[model samples]
Target: MASPIDNNVSSAKAVLLGALASGVNGPTWSMIKITFLTLGVCLAAMLALAFSSSDFIMIIHVLLLVVISGILLVLLNRFLAETGLVSIEQQMEEMGIATKDQIELSKKS
Candidate 1:
């Protein structure tokens, strides 16, 4: 017979994996596209400026900051969403796993 702890571990892993895999199915993939667009728009305009000039150089620096901020925001959002879903699923699984273990232990008794 499997230990209740083993079952819980596997259940937790499965829930987290499924929650993560959910990203592949929809607008979750859209994060890359949006981030890329923001980066391009910010960087390209300054690139179009001639002479490697000081003003445009400063603009390029600001665009780099925007790119960093934009990418970080998207990543944090994705991480939090995935983690929240996994947490909810794990909580639900805990109740079901506990009941099954109780029944198994009762049978053993």
Candidate 2:
């Protein structure tokens, strides 16, 4: 019979393993990358505003920066999706490495 402490340790290990496995296949890392990219853009815009002496010019600059950033992000997202960096399913399909039929056959087995 196992002691309570051993059981707790085993349970903790199981929980840790499950969490790591889930995280490995999760989108959290991609979301973190996107969030950092957005923050970097915002920081750059703030730096640009800081460098300008006129308040009106600063506002205009910030607005233009935001609009340009939005457009750029949209284009980048579309480009990444097309390139299959955003979708593993698309990437596999594009490479012809994993077709739907192959997946279905594997599942049937």
Candidate 3:
């Protein structure tokens, strides 16, 4: 009785749920945040560069910005881990209240 549109919708929902269920730890979350932040910066930079720079040069600058931002975020993550501060995983677990592994174990009980 389901229409093709309904099937597609359900399939998309399943895929989205599966992605959410996949373990996304603190570093991953940080990187995702960094990517969006970098994107915003790139957009602003592109607007500013539009009049002054060629298309190719603008593209190259954006790429370089992305790479540098990623590297910096990675280093920050490592530094946090290396320090005696609370680990990223612990912070995420605390914020999430219950991780996927915990939920699975609870389900089995």
Candidate 4:
């Protein structure tokens, strides 16, 4: 028989693998598409500026892209969570990965 800890680990792995295989929801996918489009446009603009200038530091370009992507991801995630479309706690409870009693007990511990 598998221990409870092993079961939890296996279940977590299964959920993660399933998510990786199934992809995201429609709204998430749309947001992802927009992110890529925005990134592509930014890259194009950066490239244009770099070509026009004599001294273009590559680190600035990398930092700009990283910062923009990070901000976009944070804002989009908050929007999704606010819209009730991406609640990890709710999903875990529904999926039997967690329960109110277990959560309460864990908290007490």
Candidate 5:
């Protein structure tokens, strides 16, 4: 018989693997798409600022700040996405619902 700890580990591993395999699945994809869109808009804005400014030093400063801010935004987005996925999986497990069955039930409902 397996110990409870072992069972929990297995379940956690399964959940993580399932999450990775389902990359950008419905809800996550929506969040990711938003993140990308936001980044694109910010980049465009930075480029416009750089072009409209007369000072070379100011342009360089704006570009550097934009790069750092973009990196931070991407990292935060990734962290939030992972956290959201884990919470979602835990909620499903607590409700005693497997992914496939959940899908089928949702379709039926």
Candidate 6:
């Protein structure tokens, strides 16, 4: 209901702000925060669904939701690790494409 709407709005705001923060500061951290927040929201949505529906039906829904989310998260994490911001940042740094101040901290490390 209204709660879901409110959660969605706030979550969207967090994502937008996270992007902005990443742009001005650390892209890697920013992307990590955004990804984690998104995962959190997904988990929350599934939990909310359990609240809205109860008994054996709710259990089935939650089980399916968690399974799907776990699979997706695992795959995405692996993909990102294989081609993370660090790699992109390194390329940008080498090419002098990043702003003087926007250099990625993770890449520097």
Worst 10 residues of 3 by lDDT: 1-10
Candidate order (lDDT)? 5, 4, 6, 3, 1, 2
Tens digit per residue, CA lDDT, model 6, 1-109: 1222223334344444434432321344465657777977877787787777766787787778777877876786787666544333333444454544555333243
Instruction: Compute the lDDT of residue 18 as modeled in candidate 1.
Output: 40
Candidate 2 backbone clash number: 0
Task: List RMSD in Å for every model shown.
Answer: 10.4, 12.3, 11.3, 10.0, 11.5, 11.9
lDDT of 1 at 60: 64
Model 4 is weakest, by summed lDDT over 10 consecutive residues, at 1-10
TM-score against truth, every candidate:
0.30, 0.36, 0.33, 0.34, 0.39, 0.40
lDDT of 4 at 43: 76
lDDT (10s digit) by residue, model 4, range 1-109? 3323224444445445335433333434455667677887887777677767744686477557767877887886687566644333334455676778765554455
How many clashes in each structure?
0, 0, 0, 0, 0, 0
Cα lDDT, all candidates: 0.52, 0.50, 0.52, 0.56, 0.57, 0.53
Report the number of the highest-TM-score candidate: 6
Candidate 4 regions with alpha-carbon error over 4 angstroms: 1-23, 56-109
Residue lDDT tens for model 2, 1-109: 3323223334334333323442211143355456768876776768576667568777776767767766776775676556442233223334454567754544455
The top-ranked prediction according to lDDT is 5
Candidate 4 global CA lDDT score: 0.56
When 2 and 4 are scored with TM-score, the better candidate is: 2
